[model samples]
Target chain A: MRGGDAGFDEFVRERYDQLLRYAIMLTGRRWDAEEIVQEALLRCLRRWRRVPADNAVAYVRKAIYHEFLRVARRKPQVPLDELAEQLDLEDFAPAVVARDHVLVVLQQLPPRQRAAVLARVVLDLSEAQTAVELDCSVGTVKSLTSRGMARIRQLWAAEQAAAPGRRGT
Target chain B: MIAEEQEYATRLREELADVAVRASAGQVDTVLRQVHRRRRDRRNQRIQVFTAMAVVALAVAGAFAVTTAGEHAEPARQVDATTPMAQWPARGELAADKDLVARAEQAWHSYRQPPRGPLKPLFAGVSPNMSANMVVVALIAPESGQVAFVTTPIRVNRPSDPRDRLLVRAVAPVTPEQRGVGFMASRPLPEDEPPIDQNAVGMALTSPAAENGKVYTSTIDSQSEPSWPTTVVGALWPQYEMGAGAWNSELRVQFRGAASTEDYTLVTGVSDDVDLGPVALRRAGAALRAEGPGVRQGDLIITPNGVVGVVAAPDGTVDTRLSELAAHGTVGVAISRVPGRVREVGDHAEFTATGPGDFGEEQRLVLQAWDEPRLALTFAKLAGYEPHWLVARTAGPDAAENVLRLGKPGAAKP
Candidate 1:
């Protein structure tokens, strides 16, 4: 295969899903998130020849993250409930439903803590990788992840206490 | 509780796995198409830039060839200061299209004058040989010494001929000092009116030669009229008798009084030509007949030249011609929020005025509705600014008839 075609097909097959999932996590809104993903992918295609083959996925993921942040910043502040409404659960499994609930709870944390939690839990990246991705120290990333988990636990415990009969469910 | 945290992490991993990474069908294609279009546009732009550079290079080379071939080219040709170089080509010819003239004219018309009388003629009747769509007129008040320049966008239906459809695009105000000399009016003060003070106002006239030479004295107290028919002492005052035949002349008058310590001057061009005198009056009359008596004072009569003739009436009836001139002189349109007490929900506040001179001329009208927070909020997010939702449902003949959505930052009703 020619260099450009080989690069393009490989990028689509390898990184398309991961970028879309990241975009969905960032924007909450399905259609807008999809659009952000598409834009980032196109930008990647334009600079495909220049990107190192080994770090192509990382580069595209960063592009998606940046585009998501840009759109979020430009948009007016939406209520947390309105953001939740933008999420779709048609194909959600029990695990997916739990994850969605956790995402809602996680949003209450500050932006840095939320990023740390998403990187560690959702992305399953190492603490050092999360720190590098977030442009913070590993120690800071560890502390933020710890605090984020604690906050989520406290919120869930309060909810369970408020509803005694539905504890198992 | 620790097990639940582990479960949450597992669920997040499952959800991330379930998340689809691929774009919707054709989305990639669409994006690629957009990229291709942008690349094509960039390529076209580059070709155009290269072509322009090549043409310029060729022209320079040809000029050099001509100069080198001719021994007579040794003596550098001297050009008159007023007349631009013909062989070298005038920048005005290249830049002076219908749009440029229209833009210049619009700018001249939209120029904001200090709270004072009409603007003087900047220049009228471009050289017949020059085919231009744009014309800029600048007027400076001799008394206040405030200068106003307007550039208008114009569309010339007849580019080959000097006279044709001269549609003005937009009028904007420019700095006064930048306007050429002889564009501003200067006048001597009358002794009886008041002593000339440093604060006295001066004016310059530009258009309508009939009103050009006449100088008007501004009085601080509306009740106090200037003592005219006194001896014209100042050397600035040239002796010229008003001919029985209709003549177009510019007059500059300066006044000083207790109410206004500064010299206040008014410059206007008067045309003894009867034909032009009543065009504005006749138009205003027609507007009154059609629109009924909504026409009041403080409205503007915008001319094709984009000159704003304001309607000043302390009384209901605008009977006096001099009052008309003083009120409607070339000046800035004043836009202010309607008194909130007078404004109510669902009710649009309207202001109207008659033309200054003839009934045939077009009158001015402006309507503003109270802005609703909800509507403004929705549009503000989309537009990036709170836009003033004012609609010009109806305008006189010369006014632009489009529904303009003015952004709040630099909102002007005119």
Candidate 2:
């Protein structure tokens, strides 16, 4: 890692966007999600030699999750409006709004549960993989994902019900 | 339910797809440059914290595993709740006793995890003015490396009213796990010439964590108003229970400068190196076999059901997995005797150097970095281990140096 800036650069270029997406799931705010990924990347660079090359992506992702857990403890139950303040709301693109609406609900899930859902579903990690990333057992992944998804389903359902016409999409 | 899970997964991927880093390449490069600069600055600002391992040449030094081997290990629960607190030294006691100050610095700030109940202070008495002063007691589960504390007032450690015997009795042994605390004079690393030595102070003890306290960061925040009482002493004994985290058990210490109003908290965490994968449960004879949970290099495992069974293993590996009943279940607790508290037990005391290696290199670095390598050697001496070769392999590589035994006293040997 002493002279490995090149590898670090390439990792950022290829994985930054992907890492951001993962962060969004863990941290509802785009700003915090990006910040977590960025900080993790910096640390990844510091301990670069110790981390196996094959596990770089997973390394950063796990760091993101751990960062979320630590940050979650520091700032408890963030309000949706405060999260909104992190964004430039003028755009209001439907994709952005849709993500926003869902995040509002997702924010209600515990940090661990949110990380579980993102890993199992969005990131497409298996129960074992999710467990490893989140530092829990496979059984825990199942339970967290199950409970988290159940809540998301309920919220998604309610959202659709309110805007039946918009639900067509 | 599986289909529903898949549906939920699919919807999330679609909805959250747009989320990505928008920072331009130039912006990113700038950030990296800034990060690199900060790292460089920190290293430049760094002081020599044990640049050389005070090399002392001698014989009769090799890596020794003086492990108590659990046979004689006392279950923390079974251990007597004796108060091990050091008496608060008088102002005269604060006079330049370099050796005693070094001993206090070397004392293990953290003790082994005690079972939860209520904590008894090694010995907490009133300050010179009779403002009650007590040490905080914390429990750490060796298996989980999880720590919990019996929160107490700075002035009144367990707050026992003279009339409240029942209250005191019920809370007498609150912690269920082993317990310990670190008492360094400086709460933080001083940025001056010798960042290694905690700012040589008159008498500054750490203030416990509180909402009304001024200690901001968990680390890198030290404020010791060097007054008298420098040769202070206190110990953490179990009194009450503070539960462990399911995993990622953290060690938290609240420190306040005895002379300053603000207090700070320092935290570190420990967890089993678990592996989780498509392990097929198999039994070969009386013993059950599974490719133990190293699922992958860094993936974590959690039990589906809340219960995790602790299994007894000759080596402390399979304790945090599923039990036969909890099986097909992730492993659970298999309690065994873990190394307990390090206190004045005759001429020797024990300190758990969990820096990342079985040897004490990392711990040495931490102590030395915090200006306490001499403290490590001092503990080694207290434990009656010669200064030639010691090992703290369970800690980290930085830990390798911690356990090295350098040499004999004045008697010279090659």
Give the candidate number with the greatest lDDT. Answer: 2
DockQ in order: 0.13, 0.13
**What fnat does each of the candidate structures reach?**
0.24, 0.32
Task: Give the DockQ (C-alpha) for candidate 1.
Answer: 0.13
Question: Looking at candidate 1, what is the lDDT of residue B414?
Answer: 34
| Candidate 1 lDDT by residue in tens digits, A1-169 | 1355356754665555566567666665455766687677767666677777877766777677677667766777567787565443432111123334445665566656766777888887898887777777999988988887777667767867988664432
| Backbone clashes counted, model 2 | 115
Candidate 1 residues B73-148, lDDT tens each? 2233442222211121111111224344444444444434232443342322221111112233333344444444
Judge candidate 1 against the unseen true structure and give its global Cα lDDT, from 0 to 1. Answer: 0.37
lDDT of 2 by residue, B265-288 (tens): 122111111121222233445543
Off by over 4 Å in 2: A1-6, A85-98, B48-414
RMSD of 2: 26.6
- Residue lDDT tens for model 2, A75-142: 76777687655443422121233466667777878888888887877777888898899999998898
| Model 2 lDDT, residue B312, Cα | 37
